[model samples]
Target: MPCGAQAQIIGYDQPDAEGGEGAAQAEPYKPSKRAGRGKGSRRLVVQPYIEVNQVVTAELSPGDDVLTYTEVAAGIDAGISGQRNAVSASVRYERRIGWSDRASDGDAISGIVRGYATVVPGVTIEAGGLATQVNVENGGSALAGGLFDGDSRTNVYSIYGGPSVATRAGDVNINANYRAGFTKVEHSDAFVATPGGAASDVFDKSVVQVADVEAGVAPYDVLPVGLAVAGSFYQEDISNLDQRVRDMQARAMVTVPVSRTVQAVGAIGYEDVEISSRDALRDADGDPVVGSNGRFVTDKSAPRQIAYDVDGLIWDVAVMWRPSRRTSLSAHVGRRYGTTSYGGTLAYAPNDRSQFSVSVYDNVAGFGGHLNRLIDELPDDFEAVRDPITGDLRGCVSSLEGSNCLAGALGSVRSATFRAPGIAASYSRRIGLMNAGIGAGYDRRKFIAAEGTILASANGVIDENYWLAAYISGALGRDAGWSANAYANWLSSSDPLVGDVSGYGVTAAYYRLLTQRLRATAAVGIDGATRDDPAINDIWTASALVGLRYNF
Candidate 1:
């Protein structure tokens, strides 16, 4: 029998490759609905556009300067939905021409793409990519809007691709998945102000790989209770300090049906996790060597030292409940990585006009691994949110399922391995002709470093981050509309030099259709940032934009 047919019979959904405490369980398959498309049909929409805008910015604090510029941009918004594939992408290129030398001029390319393609009856290909620009302060903090000076701007890129297989062998279901990802930070000059001196250890680049396989039988298929065996592997190689992390695990799971709407699950696993890195190069004076790019020079000849190593048995018990078609909940408490871990996910859709979702997660990884996992979780159908003034990705996507936000993952770019525990929630609703949504999250990281190394000072350090984003849009009659968005972020580090940082921004835009193919827009926004360090002054800027777009 085919996998799809077996899935329908046994109620076994696709296995989650990224295994953790809050793994997904067996559930009925739900088909997504595409606008103006029938079952098993194909549809594609592509819109090419050209835009021109006049922008002005004024520094509100620490200086009195007004700058003016003109922007020319070209972009395409495309989406395709078919029986075997689904894709959505938006790409844009913009050139800025300044009226004066001090106004700053440059070119930027920003975009996002995510999709999946079915290769065969039981195999599929999944891929995603992201490119955006951010302002990095000297204290290792990132600001959302890029209206600041050019010297503080940097670009970030990440891409991941993988293949997944799902099949059935008689009464047993088999599934497997593999993924490889690359992430890079370009022009990063951030540093930490230490009491001894300044330390430059920002994230540079990394490659991450993950794989998982599982074979199982549903309850009552061959026995009274379900049984399964699974194995997984994860690894990440960081260019900074030549750091590496590897984790391997194998487990056996059982499922017991408590009732028609609930089930109890238990799993016992053995896991081996290790983190290792080489020391930085040292000079004759016993000082670490610094490269021209303001980062520590890795000592290739030095032997790798173990930072963290744990090997032991892990166990967890979980509950899965589905009371209705619109409500589902899954939760688990486990012991892994030599510690207690707990996580869960809850989704509730009271009606067609509203949705609510919440998730809690715990993991140990570098910057690249966390980013890749978040991108992989995004839905295939979504609207990319962008800043109105700078046209940069806002770290979030709008969709009917819920707002998928990445603000927590992008909070810090430090080049150290840490254990992260976080929670995120989102709510979206349609009130008459208006649509509104809000997303909020909190993240905490505890650093881990080997003793007797240059990075020993960072050991046991903790950093906390909080972020919120909200947006609302409504129609202003037939061919006109308005939208507003606001965001805020807060960071607190145990290191005194890094201290605390906070930032907030808001933007509103109005558009009107003048003809069948032409549209006019006007927008205004203000962004501000503050740091606890007295030496670093506060920054505030206000910007305005007037633009026209032609669709082809």
Candidate 2:
């Protein structure tokens, strides 16, 4: 399951390959003739640029209006690669000036960074951050594609950091890791659709922390079978309704070698999982009190009521196989959280130019904790994909390790905690001078709320989301290039009033190097959203942009 550190430790027979004996013996090191010219050499690249563009947007439904604006932006892209550290980051700030009185002027900042560094012989530090904009539907869904021109847009910020220790004491290997994260959503309180409609409790902010430690010996090293012990702790504190979720577990594992390249593992453990929250304040008429920001007011004197509490024995069986260097698989079936749970990961790389991967996960967390975990799993070295007009980070990143996508996590922003089980797959390949990739996923969230509370209506509610995204880019020539991307999303909820929602968008861009320090770009895109409810109006818009950038 994706909820606890146990999921990360199961179905694996080898110690972490980063600083293990197997890794050190896999490759032979040769001394270089020139000093500071091999792996010790450092490489750095930094590019600062200024940009200017003109954007035009035309409304296609519910109204006939045209909006125009001039945008000025500045940004920097930097990367560093060495034996001890590897990092990459991009940041941009833009300000728009409208040409007409009815047009609204605004500014935005967006960026992404992920990296890791080796502080000592067997210790490493890793960190990442993300800042972006997203469109929020009045009902519940949040879309991260295309650009919107009104107050429906909001900013999201998240950051995480941790340290990992891996070392060997004689024959036993010790591994430990700890991570802390924080996430916040700005302007999320504008989710109230109508005066008398159902109130939407959007997420506010949260703090998440996770720690894991294990000691084990590989099979055939100390005995006929491998033996290990592990323990983990996970906690999340959500500001909305003062909610909290905590999980702690300890287990003993045994691994038996099935073949030269396969292993069977089994584990039994004790786990305690709890979820609790406070109720909202009430008025004289017993009606829930609403704050000025359109959210429920938390009663200071209210007690924290338990929504879920389960403690018992947990057991799991798993298999790990590595037939060759290009193929690997890990799968497990277990009983956790008082239910049957299962998850797995599969990765195949036929060659240096093509790769495929799939992952299935089961997790329980709030909006902030889920988002923080997604960021934490991103690759250490990657190129951030961004929307051309909005400058917001796209849901995916391109990397040599494997393409990481977040479409499954960005489906909803409701304040209630949920149990999420989802599956995602991605394929990427390099063809000549072109690169192409696609990702698709399905996610289901079952909300959990305390009975007899003001949020009782949300208890046991289920929401399902499906999404697809793809992109193709190549070089037009030595000094020119072109790219295109498209995405689609569909949402279904058990709530009748909320009904179903669907959204889609497509964008294409062309760029040419005009000079050694200057470049020109042009892009066009269209976006649309619709809901099954008749009272809500469908939205459609078309936009175009022309820009010039100078690198310094």
Candidate 3:
């Protein structure tokens, strides 16, 4: 029941990871098995835990073409994207609401709610919610170093809560839960004109709102009869914007008996998407000059299109088999044809000690969004603008004309009203107190223009794909209480074959138990990226923390 705190940093390069739209909206983290202890009465139990987190380093380097991170120069990368030096404090609260157990003389009808707010008491039925809102910075979200010349300050909020009921009939057990939530993005804007002939609002203040609902069920105790079902539905709408969107998904899985020592399980799922946008770039030759003092006036161009509202569906099927308590093998296949598409993964495990796996995904959208998301842009790859005589491409726009051709051409401002498909996979293993994982995947993304967009947004065909990432983690000693982790990532484009990305980082930490319910921890890390001009060099970030837990 890893409820609230979600880790979306893995998607630093994924623009539309938030909503199907190519906007920088808040994203929620998925649930993890390590969230709660393994053994506990199924009936009604509550475990409360807390931890304090902080950032030790925040750095930003953009050598033109803010979208440079999307490139992959190597075959595979082990690096994590979105490198920043940000420091902020956050609190996570969550709860698992489930039915009671019959094996422990429990009523089997009761449940419990967990979180930082209020804990629910034991009862026949239970209801609760999970939410995590954090204020983060980056050029994409308009906070730190702006990517593609766009930067701002904003926060992401994600929340979902519902109710559930579970009961047993004869020799069978059943459980179900339903939840819904929203991801919202807010921003501010103004106008600017450069000598490059570019004149228009440099930023815009708008809000993108998206809503979703998800439900899951599991049945147990019936002759290898473990079964689960889940579904999700979503919609995205922007204020003062002209894009419409909708999405839905449903899935199921079950296990089969192949003897006490052997078991087989499989799952399947499907999803649908729809989106549309028609906007303008400039009203007239100099319509960008409407405002002179930083104020902006809406300019219009004829209605155009990126990718139409496309209805799409994709599915996945997989099976797993275990020969012993320590060994297992599984295969999964997925296929999708939509505005965004993806699929595949196979995994093998020899024991609790080791495993291997691989997978892939891709997504192509309409256009890109600019800083503050107040404007939309083109796919210029505009790295520089040289002076005809001086040959100097130095500095910002020299004038309004330079602005329109070079400034407006920044492609720094962009946002698509829709999305495309994506895929990914990898293998991981645990070896004598140490865990190592390495794998590779590719992303084929399409950038479309946002509806009502007045900036750029080439209404043509353009695609971006890249890959590479590897990682390893392990503990050095029990008496020394030290652990080490490392990884590297690389990316690049296939068609144009120029823009590329590569970086790696490593960290080591030590831990000590201060008390039965409390622990103290410390760690430091170094980072290096080839993409960084002059090589950003070895950046050292450090942190320390004390956490407590309670099982009630």
Q: How does each model score on TM-score?
A: 0.91, 0.92, 0.44
All models: lDDT?
0.75, 0.74, 0.30
lDDT of 3 by residue, 32-84 (tens): 21111122212221233343322223233322111111110111101111111
What TM-score quantifies how close candidate 3 is to the native fold?
Answer: 0.44
lDDT string for model 2 (1-552, tens) is: 122122223334321224333331211101111111113237698899999999898889767789998989999988787887777888899899999986789888888887777788667776778888777775567776465587777787888877777777998877777778898877547244455345557788889888877788877688988888888887889887888988888888888878765777788999888988999898897777788867788887999989999899999898777666566676889988889988777767778788787877777888877777667656555666666766666667665444377777778777888888888888877899988778899999998888877666678888888988877788998999988777788888885546788888888889899999999999888888888888878888888889998999
- For residue 107, what is the lDDT in candidate 1? 82
Candidate with best TM-score:
2
Question: Per-residue lDDT tens digits of candidate 1, residues 1-552?
Answer: 012111101112222322334343443221111111222337798889999999999999767789999999999888887877887788889899999999888988888888788887667887888887767665455666445456777777888887777778998877777789999878545374653363636788999988777788888889878888877778889998898878888888888888767787788889888988888898897778878887788899999888999999988787778666666677878887898987777777788788888877787888788778777666576677777787877757775564377777777777888888889888878888888878899989887777766676667778788998888888999999898888888988886557688888888999899998899999999888888878878888899999999999
Pairs with backbone N, CA or C atoms under 3 Å apart (clashes), candidate 1: none
Kindly report which residue stretches of model 3 are placed more than 4 angstroms away from their true locations once superposed.
1-181, 184-233, 238-242, 248-273, 278-306, 311-342, 355-414, 417-421, 435-440, 450-479, 491-501, 510-524, 532-552
By TM-score rank, best first, the candidates go 2, 1, 3
By TM-score, the better pick of 1 and 2 is 2
